[model samples]
Target: MYASFFGLSQDPFSIAPDPRYLFMSERHREALAHLLYGLGGGGGFVLLTGEIGTGKTTVCRCFLEQIPADCNVAYIFNPKLTVGELLQSVCDEFGIPHGHNGPGEETAKDCIDPLNAFLLRTHAAGQHNVLIIDEAQNLSADVLEQLRLLTNLETNERKLLQIILIGQPELRTLLARPELEQLAQRVIARFHLDALSLAETEHYIAHRLAIGGRHGALPFDRAALQLVHRMTHGVPRRINLLCGRALLGAYATGQSVVDRKIVAKAGTEVFGDLPAARSAGHPKAVAAGLGLVAGVALLAGLGWAMGVKLPWTGASPTAASSAAGPHIAAARPAASQASAALAATATAAATDHFADLFTTLPRAEDAAWRALAADWKATPDAAADPCEALPAQGLQCFRSTRTSLALIRQLDRPGLLTLTDAQGRPAYALLRGLDARNATLLVNGQPRAVPLATLALYWRGEYATLWRTPPLDDRLKGEKARAAATAQWVSQQLATLPGVATPASGAAAGDSPRERIYRFQLAQGLVPDGQAGPITLMLLNRATGVAEPQLQK
Candidate 1:
């Protein structure tokens, strides 16, 4: 009803899980990364859990789109069935014939035999099969056990069938039961999707509005957005409900913009006279009836809770938009670019890292990326997406949720680290220096040295960094014209590295580029896939003096 009034092409707040409207927040990206990691994990249970309406389904939908051409997927949205019914559903979804062939009814074995046969047949054809069960928390113990047993079908190398379980937090608790220990042990990857922080909430709202085709500035000001986050607790679904109604409230009352008043009024209508929303007059509550609304403002209080900065610190939205830039930047020689005095000052500031100075910068993700960009001395277009803009400067961004501090140390560069803050929200910090015991983190762009133990308390091994793109990078896309150039460069770089023999003549027989890349990868402790991927190239760049940031040891 308010769509035209708001000049939106569609109802931006619709609760549908539309992929176009999917906002890939830092947490959502990690959740999707975990799902993607499961595809190559050789076949085991990959679990994703979250609170209701926290975007599990949305992430699953996004994951579905990214499934490779060779992988066959069977998805079950409803798991509230008996073991037999679930087994039958699996057969039905996979198109495997099961159930009674004769007079008697079919047993669980009836379904398993055919399913196993199907899995083996597909495995022989070099195709992987994945079964995703959504709302798995409702699954019975017997059903869960049967699902686990399905994983027993395997080859000597890997299990034939991979299963993914998506559900709410209770799913984690359910898996923790003593009886389900065996099943839990089989989980190869798991990530809990947390609700968005206030900044993310604002971005989420703007993302949906932009997808809905809104023009110009947001109808809801910053205060209204803050109120929305407070009322909805940063859950996407709740934000939708309140924002949709608040827009309608604006349209009916003929208000041009949605302020705190409209949101509080809409909250009352949506949440009703709930006790939480009807508390006695408190200073935190803006109005007598807005007891349920969050009283704390998003900028200062939210920043402190999550250990990030807000726009009040003189950083513009352009900087905030690049928060967690699309591509991960490389981390190395960070201190090399800074003057010795500045580097020493940053190192000294590490111990007092979380001091009052921390609150005066941009968001954690933004500060980390900016700090990284500064270290590299590459100017990425602030108004454009950093991932897209950085490549123009001969730089490449690599992001991975499965990386660790060990790998970061191996990469020997300063990069961004995702940390869990005091409020359990995802925070960001730039890792600039590391030694055995203490690591220096550029929190809000200031070096704060913290013990590895302290860093582990919040960091979960997810990181992003930048690397200098090799000159041969463009030729790597199978351009026939550059094939010789690419191979020659690869051979030359490898010949200079240790343990790689330099070819005597123009080219050595059987000494292909792939073989040389594989050998280089082995020496560098990278995945030896015989392909010159980003990380492999980054290591090569580092070894060949291609000049990128370096982490202080």
Candidate 2:
């Protein structure tokens, strides 16, 4: 009804999996990349999951349209089937004549025999057979195990069948069950689809309207778009539902342009009355609510309890958006739950993720101080605050937030990064060392060597790095020219600090004090390649207490 009034040929915001209406946001495009990569791989399961309405079906349909000609795909939309029924459905989708006997009887054995034969023939013909199961979270454990057995049917080079399992986030949890460890191992690629961002949401609405034959300007105004994003949380299906209703409301009210009020009024009908909608108008109330939540979260030994959803910090804006960098989008499938938890910790520590905003507490994240502490033989205090306890141990902790790779590399010293677990309890990691190819992260005092690319997946542009120097003066930030003085100062301090290894005699015999500085760099977790720039001096200043000692905020 609204379409005709707005001069559109069709309904633009219909929540149907229409290929023509598909809007591939950056996150969705990365999702497609993972699926397509699976098809080109040595044949294993490809997993795609998201919260409901993240366009898994749209991506899958898109994948199907682009499937290779030599590949035969059997797409299973509903996976709530018994093991026998699932096998039969696969045979039906593939047009494989199975479960028939010479006596004109059908049995499970009959089904298996013909299916295996069909797979062998397909492989002989130099073709690939892929089985894609959607809503796979509903599959029974025994049935999932059966699917795993099916994957075992293989040739010398690869399996006879490649599978793609698509479902909601629960599927990831389901697979994590100890019983499904084998099946989980077979998932060579996995991606979690996130909601659209505010910018992408605008593009999505426009793309759908254009596809629906809107030739001129957009019907919904800017305010309308913003409200729609807030109300729908940039979820595609929710956006569609709300937009469609908003258009209807505008048409009913005899207004041509959909505005903020139209969306606000329509939201009542679509999602029902809620306290959250008032959040925009009453920030103080929301803040109070947030405080209550934070108290509860902290008491419950949880961090996310601070809010229903994690706040988009300067560095941790809805991770995987265009803001988080393209390399961060292809989420490295976590090696295990422990690794996954560590990634979460990394994100929460990215306090400087916001473009213009900086972390209020600068001295809480210095990786240099953490590194110096690590080199010292003292066990980090559990009973005493690290800042206070370390000082008693003849050391001081200082922190700073860095926003980019260059800024971090500029500091050129060991730094402590804050990590938050799923519950939101913040943890800390010492970035012991890094190079072009890898990073040495000290998680819980255990050294974890992670690929540079893998670490980027969780690095949200903010990490707490430590410095042992007195507080940094803004003018001295990039002061690279004074290396000799700073190195000499640190060399003398090393002997006084307890358990610190003093440099070998003649270490400073060189004209430039190069070996002495290199020894100091190695002690402080700087990549000991022996080029002293501003980072070396800044760290050196921190080590000799040239800056004022400050406690963590």
TM-score of each: 0.58, 0.51
lDDT of 2 by residue, 222-334 (tens): 67788899888889999999898877654433344565555666676578654434544454543443333233224322323453322212222123123323432322222
TM-score of 1: 0.58
Off by over 4 Å in 2: 100-107, 279-553
Predicted structure 2, TM vs. truth: 0.51
Candidate 1 lDDT score at position 516: 69
RMSD of each: 17.1, 22.3
Per-model clash counts, in order, read: 20, 32
* Predicted model with the maximum lDDT: 1
**Local distance difference test, per candidate?**
0.72, 0.63
Compared with the true structure, what per-residue lDDT tens digits does model 1 show for residues 243-356? 997886554333446666667767776876444333312324425423222221323346556866433233221232234132201111223213323433553354245433
